[model samples]
Target: MSKNTQAPIPDSYPMTGGDGDYSYSRNSFYQRAGSEVAKSIVDNAIQENLDIKTISSSVSRNSFYIADFGCSVGPNTFTVVQNIIDAVQKKYQSDGLSSQVPEFEVFFNDHASNDFNTLFASLPPPRQYFAAGVPGSFHGRLFPESTLHIAYSSFSIQWLSKVPEELFDRNSMAWNKGRIYLTNAPNEVSEAYAAQFAKDMKNFLDARSKELVAGGLMVLTALSTPNEIYHFPVSPEFMFDLLGSSLMDMVKDGIISEEQVDEFNLPVFLASPEDMRRCIEKNGCFIIERMELLIPLSSINAQACAMNIRASVEGLISKHFGSEIIDELFGRFQKKLEESINLVEEIMTKRRNQLVTVLKRK
Candidate 1:
């Protein structure tokens, strides 16, 4: 890979591991809820769009392969993969191929430092599918060519492979100074982030295209900022609004250096449906079969939402800002979040932009 597309560092630590209260497995209920909400849409997509007969017959008659990309140590990945397996079985039975139902193998993928031990230990027993853990950034290929029948990812892929290198160079126009996120960022900074997202997502699609057999299907569900919304301010990942402010507050108090603030930026990019469509079309390996948006986090309260963010980003934050400040930073975050509940309540009711897109490999 070129310098522009360099590999993500091995220690780009994933969600907090283990099954403890703060672990991603325990704190990621909102993502699991998203999987539940997306279940119907994914199942419908499989029944309506996945060329099951063609893929299974042409690819493998006795085994079906599925891969979950960007599968953190969280538990929701298990649910989403199971949903796909059940849906595929139903599709086969519906098409009078029940007798030929293939054995299922699922590949759970994530960053190399992800707690694969915990993920594997928590795997539900007597599962229908055989499970394997794959550790790597999903920006590039992990599996062999033309092997996967269905590729599923839920509430993932918003993460770029790494923070844009330009953001760290003071000489670069995109240097994000005094801010930790894209919200409230200048247009140039946001464009830099978007350019990196385009690169990461295109690499993702290209890799999946190579791994998926011809006529294979991919079901992807992710948090999206609709084209109409300037910044997706309502969701739990208001890392930009909530956590960034907390950091800046500390900066104002002289707890951390201004240069430290200038040097840091989250590697997440919340793309719109239009953005996803553009990237998919540009890759030219897959065609969108269905793209729709939904809102699913209304029931989660402020405190719960804060826990979700902490679980997802605590490792990354500690890596950059040291573990000593973690508690203080997130405490301010919770307080600010509770204080802003009214605005959040208003925005929650208005936006419906959790993007669920199903793609077919051409």
Candidate 2:
């Protein structure tokens, strides 16, 4: 389907992947860096009997379907699914429950526009496993009602569709050259983003609520910021600004046009814990069991963080700046990111990390 025709694919890129380009799935930086935090969440959910108990009680032996919403093509998916299986097996074993080993149907979902060929090719054999791709946004229904026992999404869901054009006036003015959606942009712009997030999240929870039997479980790990901050810039937009500055410098040097940079808008949105909690409560299905902040040491260092910043923006730079100038732009962009990181580090010691939440249906 065409990009315009498709509903917003949360956490998906505006463009398709090239041959052998599995950057979204293969970037071990996020998984390796975030594994410990992920493990703790799985361990806690098992220990506390968080949401699993609810689903386990309702479902027959070997009949439960466990879904990994937004499961990118990478080692993270395997790691998480294995962890869930181990947790469930241990639970059954300890209880002396002679129930047949649960048959797991793992649905690795993402946008239809995602690189499924790469994802499928990367997947290991499904010994005692059934795998399928559920394309489209998790915010919309992808599975039937009361079918899923567990759902998990990691390092995803923070992305929104491209910034809506109505956020700016029609006059085509450069209001905030270094800011996201104009530093002075109407609160409606921010609210528009916030409202979309709430709507999408509600759709996700509501759909899952219908699909999950009573007491089903959901674990979500995504990039979140403090609510009180009120105006913490979206990470992608920040990176975009960094890149835009570099592009503008090039334009001044007659390397590109102001129109080129003006045409771009990074697709990302970092929700806050409070925002998420409010949405969950509104859905009235899942109750938060545990929520923890996980900081990646690699991201904490200014230099390493800078590299990640570059990686995140690399695709957009290549698309907007053109292939010929991409390498030069990246070099300048990397230096600028390093400088930005240093400035940020001087005032802030560590990068705010992932927020891991485990919820049980109420």
In terms of lDDT, which candidate is strongest? 1
Q: What is the C-alpha lDDT profile of model 2 across 1-362, one tens digit per residue?
A: 21222222234552324333325443346545665567867766865654445666667765767888766555567778778877776766676664655777778887786667776777777545777888888877888778887788887676664554443333333222233443244565566667767777878888888877777778888876655253444332455456667777887888887655545545556677888889888888787888876664443444444455554445555655667886677677767777777545532335555678888866
- What is the TM-score of candidate 2? 0.81
lDDT of each: 0.81, 0.64
lDDT of 2 at 186: 51
> How many residue pairs clash in all the candidates, one count each?
0, 1
Error of 2 at 126 (Å): 7.2
Instruction: Name the candidate that leads on TM-score.
Output: 1
Error of 2 at 359 (Å): 1.2
Q: Distance from true position, residue 291, model 2, in Å?
A: 1.9
